[model samples]
Target: MEYKVIAFDVMGSDNGLIPAVDAAIKLLGEQKDLKIIFVGDGAALKKELSSRKHNPDQVEIYNTTEVIEMTDGIMDIRRKKDSSMVRALELVKDEKAHGVTTGGATAPFIAGCHFILKKIDGIERPGFMPVIPTVVKGKITLLLDVGANLECDPEDLVNFAVMATAYSKAVNGVEDPKVALLNIGEEKSKGMELHQKAYKLLEDHEEINFFGNIESRYLASGIVDIVVTDGYTGNIALKAAEGMGKSLLTEIKTALTKNIFRKLAALRLRKAFKEVAAKFDYKNHAGAILLGTKSIAFKSHGSSDKVAFYATLKMTYNAIKNDVVNKLKKALAE
Candidate 1:
């Protein structure tokens, strides 16, 4: 499939922003008919591109007058009409590009996407889906509403499940992927009122493989392919997992360096540790996908390095080739 171009908001000053952009552009150059649109300060972007020896001809810049501050509140989105993020979103809405990629502030990205790209038919809101690495080899689990729509209604949760299920099948190549709702307990009546309603709705849906509620303990078991929850809880769970991973690594390092004998043992197992670290490395995973949007919009971590940015762009290309939007349309219709 011929993807016209991918739009990016190159307005952040995060340490990884420029390097990530350079890496993504380099990867996209290898593919045919794929162009990139850098929506930000034209002269600055040009200078950065030149410094990296990247050909300017392959990229189109939509210069903006205003820059959205990283600390700017979500409401600032309405005031920053000339911001680069807003301009990139407009390009997607205009069909000038097939998708958008950004490592900017999450609030502005979500606000701008909703304002410009809009939502798909029958979708009340656009939910975020972040692919988390699983214990299964070469496979990842999809976590919905990572940080968007904090207080979703029961119907909204059901919509998230539908969108997430379609996304997993279309992108992960999972046929009849198991879908689970994140709850405090595993029983059917364990969660709050919203969970009860969502559970019933999911259970009633004949098209989806709605598994029973899953407790947080089994989150990374690799048994369930898609886990649905409101953004508030999902974001907390994601951050908690990251913190735990870091703490575990720190403890292991401390234990290994306790003495020379143990240090020697650590050296022998260095390769094994590296292999294990690779599984938990967030850089290998791409950015979060904004589901239910008419056009694709991915929001990468602000601290994302070159590898993560490249993965995000590559995933965007794959999503376009897979016709994810069409698949979502079909599933929503059913």
Candidate 2:
């Protein structure tokens, strides 16, 4: 029998295993086929489980005392092989689990993935792809190479687009996802030499629905389904977008309060505000899937709460159910 076990790195998060353990209990309650190997300090983990009323059959603990810190360098993946992050990667590599997730350090997590699970054939480097919400209701966009390869060549950008197309189809359920290069402008002549070369390649490629260039302003405009760029720019863009979302919420709250008339009007629009909040709630789509790896690997926000971790768990299950890795391999092969 194939057990759908997830190797969950339970350390290094903002609050450590409290949220992680809660998420595991909730997920195990939801997905009966699923089990999580919580890789961390065995004594503490067992104590947490003892407190919770979880079934012994569906939950297991993998003892590990070492944790990769955020300040740790990529070489630590080799030196700190006994760390929780590396142990989680080893579980996926050894087929002890179907997928792996970590709230640990991003650099070491990516490095551990490369050093252990290994990249799929033909992938120069694995890219971090996250599905973010757009202004358009019921629609979302996939941002690729979000924070992995900060410096990418034209070929790497092309590979990101191809891999993103596959990911969009599998996870977002878009049959013909419109792929676009994130650029300063929509014009072919705009941007630096990197996008200039990548633009020509995306246009010439017949496999994906190349939608020309997309300006950063339209990233949330729902104009395109997939935005491909180098990790540096993508990472900055993602953080900026997240910041803007917070600013918008803050501004809306300020506007809704302060006066009696406005307060009365806000009551009428409470449901509307809730609808919008749920629409752009980052927690609903938490975790970045590391593309180009041979096995399923995901990186969760270091400070994600229990709700966010639960969403990450669900996202992992969705990717696994869709056979995202093998499907991505087939797409890249074609």
Candidate 3:
């Protein structure tokens, strides 16, 4: 059939192969033109597929003798070439698949991609950038280096800005995505030397609409299209936002169900509340694209299940359709 091949690691998450298999089957039903390589234990995968009785033509399994676990480090990729994560990524490396997604350990996943796919030449290291959905309807912001480079040069930050800008334009349909450096304060001299240097580089960049510095407070306010930072700070920001999102969402539910009058009010705004909840549900698009890699590698949350895995499948499809890697190469070249 026509090749719209995608690869996924069936052994990536805590939920075993069930969620990945379910999502794969769902995706196959939704898109007939798609083909998938579910890389993992073949016997296990075949059992699951047999249970569902899906056609082998659409969803094929690549048997793996090894598996990279959460405790594995970067060197695990070297030792475990036959792992589901490595094997799935290999399909992308070999051009057998357009992209791959795995909810595996972050270190090995990045290591596997780096060791196999390599960086896109000009890129020093691949950065994990996630599109965060904001409270504003149809509004999303890109956050880069969420857990990639712990330390980065000013030019690296500039490259991230360039890459994310192109991604926003292609995927999110933003004409000119406003880019900002994440800083302790909005002032030019507020943070460390890295921020100062990166600020100058971004400010001087003609390609992106550099919006100076963006404090973390404005991240959820949807004031800018992209937020760039070193992984250390970015990771902190990501975790904090996640914790706050969960807390706030919990608080909302608790408050709404407090009494009869509030429950009645909640009943009235049920549709609206559900819509808002959906927007806040990052699990609905559960992953970040590893930009700067030779091939697209999607890193989903380790706990991701059926709905989350399905969301990453959609993300992989979008990245492939947009030719994200090539577009990023072109943008960085310019």
Candidate 4:
């Protein structure tokens, strides 16, 4: 087994570095073939590790005193050379690690990725690909450009489709992942000029299994394995889906706990409810991978706790182990 190393940006998280550190320590124990590098303040990291029981040989620390604040703009990526996020990314760039994961500010981390990691050859722009759960049990959909590029052309959509298809095959174990364009209606000509052009491009593309256009309503239905759209539209759809999932779950809880009889029923259905909750929980999903980059990079939620961090770390390790970047490159080259 080839050993894998994943770097974690241990600062800028809403809950601070402790969660990241704890998650890394736990992961190291489970994956004997994996090692971890924590990029952050040396003193704090050492202090935290002192209390945790982990294999010292599998852990390393690259100390950086600076941290990119949530308010920091994209330009700060270049300026903050010693920041935890940049250093963790640098680990991948320097070939010290196979992948990088962070619960840090999004914009600067993305900009840093564009500048430092660069894009895979032939990819015009990188897309934020998150593994979103579908209504179908144990099925997931890959939604791209959640906020990476505000606007994209037909070619970009095709590239996103190609990349997503490759990811679905390599990571999700799909034989031939079905791809769709998110539009106003299922009709090919229903959307704007961009969607129309994208539909034609995707339909003509031989690399992916194009499934035509999909409306936002059916995005979570697991009808398609991947959904491609411009960042502006995709971001709105993603947020709306998240909001609706949370609201529906909240309403269900309210309805089930309002009366004594309903409370008993809720108790009886506790396992089923947990299964549903786990499917929709952001913490379980963890990170949005920056697809089309030269190497694997993930942007975890800033508010993620230890569980979320662990999920992201495990994903990063698996992507590296599976050689996701090379598979994607091969797919694009074909």
RMSD of each: 2.0, 1.5, 1.6, 1.2
lDDT winner among the candidates?
Answer: 4
Candidate 4 structure, TM-score to reference: 0.97
User: Candidate 2 residues 1-334, lDDT tens each?
Assistant: 3568899998888877899999989988888888889999999999999999877888889998688887888998899878899999999989898899888889888888898999998999788988778888789888988889899999888888888888888887998999999999989999999999999998998887999888888888898999999999999999898889989999989988989999999999999998888778877767999999999999889887888888888788778878889988999999
Better of 1 and 4 by lDDT: 4
Q: Could you tell me the lDDT of residue 7 within candidate 1?
A: 86
Query: Lowest-lDDT window of 10 residues in candidate 3?
Result: 276-285
Name model 1 segments beyond 4 Å from true. 53-57
Model 1, 114-203: lDDT tens digits are 777888888887888888787888777888888788888888888888888888888889999898999999899998998999999999
Q: Which should have the higher TM-score, number 2 or number 4?
A: 4
Q: Write the per-residue lDDT of candidate 3 for residues 136-228, one digit (tens) a residue.
A: 668889999998888888888999999999999998899999998999898999899999999988888889899989888877788899999
TM-scores, each model vs. reference = 0.93, 0.96, 0.95, 0.97
Task: Report the C-alpha displacement of residue 38, candidate 3, in angstroms.
Answer: 0.5
Worst lDDT window (10 residues) for model 2? 277-286
List ranges where model 2 is wrong by over 4 Å: none
